[model samples]
Target: MKYKKLIFSSIGISLFCLVILLFFVLRGNFFKYTDINSMISEPKTNSLIVSGTWELSSITSLSDGSEVKSSEEKLYITENFVYFEKMGTTNPKFKFRQVNFKNYLLYNGVVTDKINIDTDDVIVVSIRDERNFYKEFIVLDKNKIATIYNKKYYIFEKKSDNVDKSIIEELSLDESSINPKKDISFLIGVKSIGTKDVDYETFLIRKNGDEKPTADKVEGLFVNNKNKFFLVNANENEVFVTNDYINNTNKISLGVKNATINFLSKNYISLESYNAETNKKNYSIYKIGELSDESQMSIKDIAGDKGEKAYFNDIRKLGYSSDNINLYDMKNFGVKRNNFSWVFKGILSNYSHDNFVSSEIDLDLIPNVDIFSNKSSKISKLRVKEKVPDVLDYFVSPDESVIVILTADDISMYEIKNQEIATLPIFTTSLKNRREVVTFQWTNAISSELTYTEFMKIKRSN
Candidate 1:
């Protein structure tokens, strides 16, 4: 009986030891692969671009160091697809379908060209010197992770910003900065084109009588009545401006997303910015190259026109008007027009093509641009069909004295009868402009383009 009791005790001890051995072996292997470092030792970590599969991480704000945690949702990335999964749900795999890289999914499909399903094991964004070093990136720090939820991308930044501030100061960049290996180039805009061989300015085109822009990438030029500014090189993050059409090159740093001449205004200007990622609106007022207290006002109190729902289509739209519809401070004004589309409505703008454009409806109707005469209530319709042959973009002088039309293959500006746009441009010997929305100082304003709400207020007060 004593020998039988000893044998039973030995069997129990051996079974317990085997179970312990298995747990340790499995746990070590699992954690070694899956556990991301809580504090990344280096500043640049692998890319956490929201695609494929990613567990929700805590979100940090750059405006203020606040963090929000949502860990239940799981959207992960594999080679072919970026899909969503949730823990306690009947539908574990939320992704509806697999799609090609050329297609941008409007619903239930994740699209990305940055990843190689066969080669890329981890998502990464790197910044080194030369072309090979560049990869698609929109980020704050290494610890920053972006997650997908509610059909939107949420960037989760680390609470601590460990990047060197001197680089940001020298480059005139905002707080969320990264240090490149050598001279830093702030190529900030999204990858407009997928193929790496294509130059960066494929979409954000520049203006020159010559051929296309020679740079690998370029920030599109912006001009206003008083100033004209453009990035010297998108890679350098250097900014230069021309004052008063005199071709005076002076350096000025700007925080605005897009620009026209006098973008900085050298005095005061108000702008509202919406983050396409988070859908947050930032109302800012710049005074002599600085943000002012007026920027702190409620979005309701901010001056100028709040972009309203287009009186046109089911598409989400906005009404953008000139600062003062009647004022013609600059001689010639240019509005950047691109992406003319051939739809069932004949020809229409598939995207926002004009600076003072709010009339997608009328653009679909015909090729005539309607202008409301400020001198009288009469509307003057310019027959644009005659000038729109392979037209990429065009410019009009503020006084309606000149019109420079840029087509896919040629640039033309010659005098015609008194249809208003019929004189030599005051500043340019040739019809060349690199700016986006120049001050359109015509005596007759494009009534359809002006912001309806803001236009009424200015006209009533006038």
Candidate 2:
């Protein structure tokens, strides 16, 4: 009986040793394949950005270090001016007010501006409204600013410019800011800013001479030169585009279903169907200038099964390139020691005619982009350090050779030549309200083209 007991004890000791060995083996293997140090050590660039939980107010700093304060809920800045939105303590609606940071430093009196200027000076402001309304604006020039408030886009020139006696041809105040370039002026959010509520079934505000935008409900607007696009929210789905807004209504098989759209280029659009079974996600590329049915081509199953629901959590609008788009996605390879599920993932950007770059996040939380030159069958990984905790937003150059990653604290400009990454931490104030509502969070990763880079860049990074 003593010998039997000794044998049992020996068996238990062997089992314990095996478990310890296995744990170390797995950990060592993970590190061996993925270089964590080199990636994290890369340089970072900063921007004058704001940071905080639930950011409602913010301050901007001049290169000199003097800070400018303003309401955080709605912050807008131009070369010479800035504005904010505010609602009285007991008021039900919001109003607009201008701010002068310089005056705040001199004395605490109200700072209001009726004119726009062209300078580096930054200001803060708050306004009050009678109804639940939001306002956005674009500073046109000193003494003039274009803005959209209470569902109307208006060009607010200096009140002094009002030559009241002659024929008095007044510009409409029912619209928001307008992109005025000589003869071309692009308006956005038309129905939202118009006097009548039409629910804006299909709309596009562009230069009167150029092609109109193609979208069901353009909620967000972006423009570069003659190229203008809208983040169209149709039925719940989004379609990203500049022109060709009218063609989609009669082409796609969207039977009242909403979707999200990301404009890739004239020939391609990144689309995601939210009403799919099990939250299934897909990417479709449509031919430019062609109708939806004639131009659209979709890829069904992506990221396998795990990505069915997890895909929704990782969608963001990074940036677009002529041929290549840059975006990030999350991955769940395994868990870490702290019991926090290891979020091991990075960017999956497309470039150069089907050429792709798949990146992985190291343990130190930096991305090492893996270049897959399929045309040449060559694979290379470039390690880049991120100043931000995680890459939240990005803007890509036309050639996809450079990208600007916007993080909570800074914005870094990354160039794809010789693997160089520059960090730029911005000098912006941190507020409470804006940070909590509009910012990046976290999620999982998958391998599929069905997922648009837009979704991956915008989804809150956890």
Candidate 3:
């Protein structure tokens, strides 16, 4: 009787547990698991990541089943666009959607539209390429994928670990690299920026209650000490100009053969045309406001050079972003009383793109000197609070709000807030074989548009 009772109790407990499991599964909590591999259906509750950069690993001719040369092209997959670049030419891409983001299908190129991709699982990827043809791809595994384009089976291996890495690389190109003939990545580097017009003349609350605006009458004057108020898009090769940055009816091709914008300042803009095959460069200059071309939004050229500025207290200005950003030691200002900290400042006047936060970190207000006493308030100020690093070199963001400090050991980024350099870094990553890197620039390559009105404002203010 004891044994029978125990058996019955065990059976009842097992039955109750089974029922509880079934109930939870039906209620969806059990199914709402968080395994990245459990990407079984659409609207997955689990967070699944998609690969962004895929290098062409191998190729095979589908018709003959024979080996082929590698094109070295890379597949850069963005949230909405899938680009096949490095074809030894400009990039080409198309819109895409997905099946649990595992399978990709061509879309109508509308960002907000809900795209339903009901295709066979065998077609891991598909694109409606030019000439209205379909390109199909198959997934080999989690790290590899194969696509068939024009009777050729091309296999690609995922390079970047995740999509964000690819996006950052794509977004971080120098503003000068934004050529209309280039891929969508460079094109988006600039076209995505916004513009603003702020009023001046009356002192707005300067941090810690400094000077008010330059005037009393406040109106949306076309110029701010932040960014240029304009827009620039383009066509295939030497696209037409949008002179006013708003109107496009008058189409005149800028004769400047897609030269890289080299120098930008309050008065002049320069373009450098490079002969890649010959390894040569030619420079040209244009006055501000009267600027043309590019999908980039920054104000000027990076003034590319293999040279580094001389040590602390070197007065020879090292021109960077738009010829504005410069790193200076306290010695540079002729303060021989005591050795001191090096500061960086950039002119973000009259062309603040994205945000006006840069105003807080402007050319003046650093070294917190008596504004009335300084012989030169002509330069802005960004003091790095005394904690100097073994900085081999540094790069400033276009807006000059942050700076990338490169040392012998690692690369670190710091936020330039008013009077406070964050004790902690935003990020620090070590680069392998630092000596092997021949050319490394951490800026976007995009062209820009400066309207006549805004240009005039900048020139007059300066």
Candidate 4:
């Protein structure tokens, strides 16, 4: 009888201990906190408030005192795991544990335990391993966040949960901004030629022109007004000039062999050539005139000393500026490309060249639009809309009254004075097609070309 009572008592004690353990686990009290008092007095909630998508805006390195701006990198925080998309890498998730009231521990390939939450909007995380020591202090709000990681500072903005539906709507043109006397037209589309498609013919969507322009194999097109227009034919290595758009009066040969016209402006046009032997780029610029007898001029001759360091590969003439141009310096951002770089670094100093003088401007913030005005001889920075697309192309109007942004499937117009964005209609055959299939070129301040149905007619017959 004594042995039986002892066995029963042992079993009861074991069951009671198991129940206690289960209660603690269910109540989330298994981990004990240190005696250190937390500065924040907010009580712990049942759910995580930091679960959202955060986009990288800017990064500042304390070691070199240099800042890099970006609109691409993103971070996804969830209840179970945290995902990071830094540089060019995709989302890599790590399992996280809420060790304390606001503390967390992340484990993937390694363990990071010193994650401390100072408040609902601030967190300080530290990690030390055999090879590296990582630390970050993060401050976050509803729309924006700033973080300091290992002496490097970073800024991020929260992404919107809802998609923008305004892109499909028609664009409202500002009547006051438009010139009533001048006739504006846009080269909207191109039609494939020949039975087997030997060439492409351009078409125009006129805003005020009496008759549309006609051209063949037009690789590039630039319009100053209804009276002045320029077209390039790379196959013939010739540039055709038209005064009335009905007939080509002059044909000018490109100075370099195998040269292609890359960019065209109102007063100047640029040609690009590649050296097969040396693998270097050679660029030439020509002043547009009614007479075809003008010779090609070096960029250095046209832009003077400023053209020496100017990037001709991605040169863009700001229509709003009478004499100023936007020079894209990609080397500062560690990118080797022929496209425009969104970020730039320079000292705030007065810049004067020829009749133009661009005032100094600072661009240390992200999601900013820097407008270089030739009329004012000043560069102004404006904080525009937030939560824009990752990859986009933007154009400012001639009067600096409006800005247009084009993405893969959408076009949005922003008013400079009000800072309000309105979605513009995309005149394409299909909305499901990717933006890469469409070709868009801005011809003038109020005109552009949006081409679709490229080589589609050939595929349809087969």
Q: What is the lDDT, from 0 to 100, of the residue 341 in candidate 4?
A: 26
Tens-place lDDT per residue, model 3, 1-462, is 999999999999999999999997875754434443333333322222334678887666444444544655676654444445312112223322233332232222222122222334421444443322234455555677776454455778989755565454554342222222221110001110122211111111111112111111111112221233322223324423233433334544455554433222233333434456634333333433454544222212211111122221122233224344433211111111002122222322223574322221212112211111112111133343244445554444333334545554655566555424567766565533231111111212231232223434433443
**lDDT against the true structure, each candidate:** 0.29, 0.29, 0.35, 0.36
Strongest candidate by TM-score: 4
Scored against the true structure, residue 191 in model 3 reaches a CA lDDT of 12
**Which residue window of length 10 is worst by lDDT in model 4?**
369-378
lDDT tens digits by residue: candidate 1, 37-78: 311123233323332323455433222322333434443332
Question: TM-score of each candidate?
Answer: 0.24, 0.24, 0.22, 0.33
**Compared with the true structure, what per-residue lDDT tens digits does model 4 show for residues 1-462?**
999999999999999999999998765533334332333333344334445666787776544544544535565444332334211111222222222323322211112222223443343332222211122324354566555543445676778532222311111121212232133223322212222322223333322322322222233342433233444444434445443233444555444555544444455544444557744444444555632335554333443443334432233222222233333211111101122222222211123563323222222322111111112201122333252444344444443434444444544444344334445322222212222211223232233321212212212322
Local error of candidate 4 at residue 152 (angstroms): 33
**Alpha carbon lDDT of residue 337, candidate 4?**
10
Question: What are the candidates' C-alpha RMSDs?
Answer: 26.0, 28.0, 24.5, 19.0
Each candidate's clash count: 23, 84, 33, 0
- Candidate 2 deviant stretches above 4 angstroms: 1-231, 235-256, 274-281, 291-294, 298-386, 393-403, 408-423, 426-462
Candidate 2, residue 103: lDDT: 34
